[model samples]
Target: MTRIIQLSDPHIVPEGTLCYGVVDTGKALQQAVATINRNLPLWGKVDMVIVTGDITDFGTAEEYARFRSIMADLALPVRVVPGNHDLRENMRTAFQDQDWMPESGGINWSAEFSDFGLICLDTLVEGHHHGELQPDALAFLSDTLKNLGSKPVVVGMHHPPFNTGIIPMDINNLRDSAELSKIIESHPAEVRLVCGHVHRSVTRSFGKAIGLIAPGTSHTVTIDQRVENPHTLSLEPGAFMMHEWRDDGIVSHIIAGNYSDERHPFTTPV
Candidate 1:
């Protein structure tokens, strides 16, 4: 069984600096790393950790360095795609030594696991908050899925192709996703779409694929569902996701960062 952990939207800033002068994103990410490492034994042999996006708030070299430093404590390997807040070239330079880092063009890559396949696509449109799967990324998805054959696959991107009720965030979602939907719908095997831009856990169906949006590692985007609500962030508890390849298909679970140490048997419930 292959299990993959998903952490998203840490928005790490430089050392001693807080994101948006409010969220201590770097520290929050440290806590998340510690939590995951502490619970690894219970989770059992996680294959890898995938950060959906927004590794740095300003996409600076110092911020990337700090993000790397915090993640170094994690007892697992990690892969990432680019989010709107991330500068593509900067991110590429930071992880250039990694095998998955593409030398040129969009940061599109794929990995083949024992039971399934994983594909990460870059949807970053520089200088823009919204996301778009450019022609190159679309082509990469098509070719990679064709090669994977009947294996169930998880596709990771920074932006959700579908809109959530949060109006501000919804407006910045992945644009022109019809082609993307068509590709996933045409695939023979199961295709699960995992994303991270909105900083909220949202599950929706896109064509035949199940789309899951992971919550952030630090602060969360406010949950107001009004059509004209103010864009904001909340100091909600952080969390990450674990996706395991079971006999039937992939099963995803949310692991909270903050929890009490005490445990009680289910039979002891009032």
Candidate 2:
């Protein structure tokens, strides 16, 4: 079994800074790390931790520095992809030593594990919140999938390929989604697409694969579907995901951040 933890959209800032003069993104992320470490003993061996995107609120060098400091505690192999809120150059600079990362272009790359191959595609469109699948990104994905053959694969990105019903977010969702769907549909293997830009948990069917949207670690977006107003962020319980690949198939679980009064012994029912 290959166990993977998915932490996304922490939007971490410098140690003393607050995001938007409201959310203490740095503290939120710190709490999240504590939460994960607390639960690690229960989950057993976690192969790696994948940060889907939006790692920093401003995508600044200082923020990335803080990000590095916090993630270093995990002491596990860490893989990341850029989100709309991220700057490609700085992100590459922050993790340049990772031999798997591409030196140029969209930052698309792949990694191999005991039970699955991870194919991470870059959907970051630089100056926009919306994501794009340019020619180069698509080509890289197609080639990676073809090379991986029939192995169970998890395609990680920063944007969901389908609209999530949140009007403001949908406006900035992945563009040319059909083209991406076509590529995944043609693949001859069980593929699961996991991403994090939505800030809320959602599941959608993407052609022949399952697409999962992981919750943000800092905050969650309100799930309002009406198109008459701007979307809002909420202080709801932040969360992450755990993707467990067993011999049968892949099972993804949503893990709420911060553990306190929720703990209880698993005593069998009388």
Top candidate by lDDT: 1
Alpha-carbon runs more than 4 Å astray in model 1: none
Q: What is the lDDT, from 0 to 100, of the residue 65 in candidate 2?
A: 86
Candidate 2, pairs of clashing residues = none
- Count of clashes in candidate 2: 0
TM-score of each: 0.97, 0.95
Clash count in backbone of candidate 1 = 0
Tell me the whole-model lDDT of each prediction, alpha carbons only.
0.91, 0.87
Model 1 TM-score, all chains together: 0.97
Weakest 10 consecutive residues, lDDT, candidate 1? 257-266
Number of clashes recorded per candidate: 0, 0
lDDT (tens digit, per residue) of candidate 1 on 99-141:
9899999999999998889999999999999999999999999
